[model samples]
Target: MKRGAETRTERRDDAPRDHLLDRLFRSEAPRLARFIRKSVGNQDEVQDLVQETFVSFVAAARTGKLRTPEAYLRTIARNLLWGRARRPQHRDALHLPVDEDFEIAVAPEQEWMMEASDFLRRYEQALAELPARTREVFRLHRQEDLTYQQIAERLGLNVRAVKYHMRKALLYLDSRVNTDD
Candidate 1:
């Protein structure tokens, strides 16, 4: 076969995948952007994170079929956010201005502490919203550091029931705390 013909054939084979990717990007990018924006205050960083999420999604899609692409995109975006959170801040350099007299900068640690406190407040509020039994199960497992079996025994419930309460508590918390408005 001619080289030119092979190139055309390869393009034809790739067309469907390309179309699928384009469609996915169109549908998912806004949702992903909103998700990232909730966590990141910077618009530039939000755009960068959204682009990175799509890049990772495309690379994974090329390797194998994604069973749930939307969820996978969310997982990828969440991991990126976590990774960004773990990195040290360079804001001191970035925010330095020409006029030293008018400088206005907050320390990174202070900002982190504020965020942590806010997260804790939201978490407590969400936990408060849970049913009494579910809240008890969560507190026993998380705050008191009890195993499911231990919690079950302590509460006079079966292991399966304890697991169910924990699951319910977790889903409720996730929806309340992690959801993007």
Candidate 2:
């Protein structure tokens, strides 16, 4: 067999038999293994998890229940990693009461996210109302990290025009953002 070639085997017969799966495996195996190794932190077990993921994929493909190859592989890797974590030996490695010194934190919930989303909407609305050239000048300065002189040079405008655009953008944003708050 040539280097990097897959060896056809009988175990793969039960699956729906797509050449794409072989192609995907060859192309994605290294990346899949790296992702698993990052989560599990075990150099030795990384290849094992990747193999098990493919085995699961073959089983899933047999059932005609496959989705995107990358997503399917990720789901399988996650399940296998969680299974490893649930083992009795590993489970008991942490038995704890609360650590008062280090408080457990909760993920940000819906209201905070909604407020942020609303703010972004208002900000976008404000930006959208700016004149085209003025908006471009402001974006070049802020987003592209260009100085006023550089922006002026790029847009073929004088430095005073660039500064005027910057001030205009800032004032509009300030008015909109403050009123919204």
Candidate 3:
């Protein structure tokens, strides 16, 4: 009613968006987690994904673009869940050139060559550093096309021991392998 005084709607419209997000998180988090858990089957990751959903919703809400906060949040959550569902399969899916009609000339840079060389050296070093038996079992099984039973017979060891060493070698290599390269 007074000049220069904000109306209730104006005050609410200008309120810090985080407070609204916090309120939404406090209220809807459990429901969202339960909803995600039914599909994801992991409680710990469900909470994290729900939090991520809230964060994305907050970012969108901060722009003051939503007409219905609750509905928008649920929609965002569903989309995030859908994306998660597709992520693993998508990564392993075969990726081909989008523009197959175009022939793009490609060349590796000197930096890339150097990185590749360094990566190979590191990989070799990691393999060399494994325990002798583990390295031998891994090399025999992977490089020599020998099965665990064959390696065990050749090495005069139990098949179980050969398997255990192979597993250890593989785990070690997996931890050391440079997937990015």
Candidate 4:
């Protein structure tokens, strides 16, 4: 009983320290995110860097090497920014905070939507290879965003058949996608 009481006391002491760390980290994240965003010009990419920075800081802290955590974090952020600036343009890099290039690349009038439509068209073709009932049910639920019961009522089929068709369609799609990859 005495040993258990001591263990509980130790845990109580550590809990507040953990809570403090959580609060500190949360406070630091938004500031870091905004700094990266203004410096690099991509909000989404800044979010990624903030996550990566926190992960690295946690790892380093775990190993007892964090003497000045804020300074360490700033050093990591600067290095990441510099490295991103130096990377080649054509590399298939993960998302990095980039300036006007990102805006131009992601504009709606550009090829992004066209490429997405092409992929969807291919998916529809693959879906059509299914039986008529399966394809119709899957399309109503997925593409047209109809509920299962709605599809059942509209098609005059039982709900169970609709569910079975959806299941088979999903399996077929999974197999086809894995093979294509």
Number of the top lDDT candidate: 1
Question: Candidate 3 overall Cα lDDT vs. reference?
Answer: 0.72
Q: Give the lowest summed-lDDT range of ten residues in model 4.
A: 85-94
Off by over 4 Å in 3: 1-15, 89-181
Model 3 clash pairs? none
Better of 2 and 4 by lDDT: 2
lDDT of each: 0.81, 0.73, 0.72, 0.70
Q: After superposition, how far is residue 65 of candidate 4 from its true place, in Å?
A: 5.3
Alpha carbon lDDT of residue 140, candidate 1? 85
| Cα lDDT of model 2 by residue, 55-161, tens digit | 98888767765446676677678667666654555434433478779775533333333444466568778899999988898788665456899898899999999
Per-residue lDDT tens digits for candidate 1, residues 1-181, read 6999999999999999999989988999999999988877779988999999999988878887776788788878987876665454622224455675786667655576456445656777898899999999998876545689989999999999999999999999998888553
State which candidate has the highest TM-score.
1
RMSD list, candidates in order: 9.8, 15.8, 19.9, 16.8
Identify the runs in model 1 with alpha carbons over 4 angstroms from their true place: 90-181
Could you tell me every candidate's TM-score relative to the true structure? 0.56, 0.41, 0.40, 0.40
**Candidate ranking (TM-score, best to worst):** 1, 2, 3, 4
Candidate 3, 1-181: lDDT as tens digits: 6744667667777676657667877888888887877656457878888889888876776666665666666767777765664454422333347696867443333333345455656778889999998899998876555678889999999999998998888888878876665
Q: Summarize candidate 4's per-residue lDDT along 38-75 as a digit string, tens digits.
A: 65545787888888887777766667645456656766
The positional error of residue 179 in candidate 4, measured at the CA in angstroms, is 54
In candidate 2, stretches whose alpha carbon ends up further than 4 angstroms from where it belongs are 1-18, 93-181
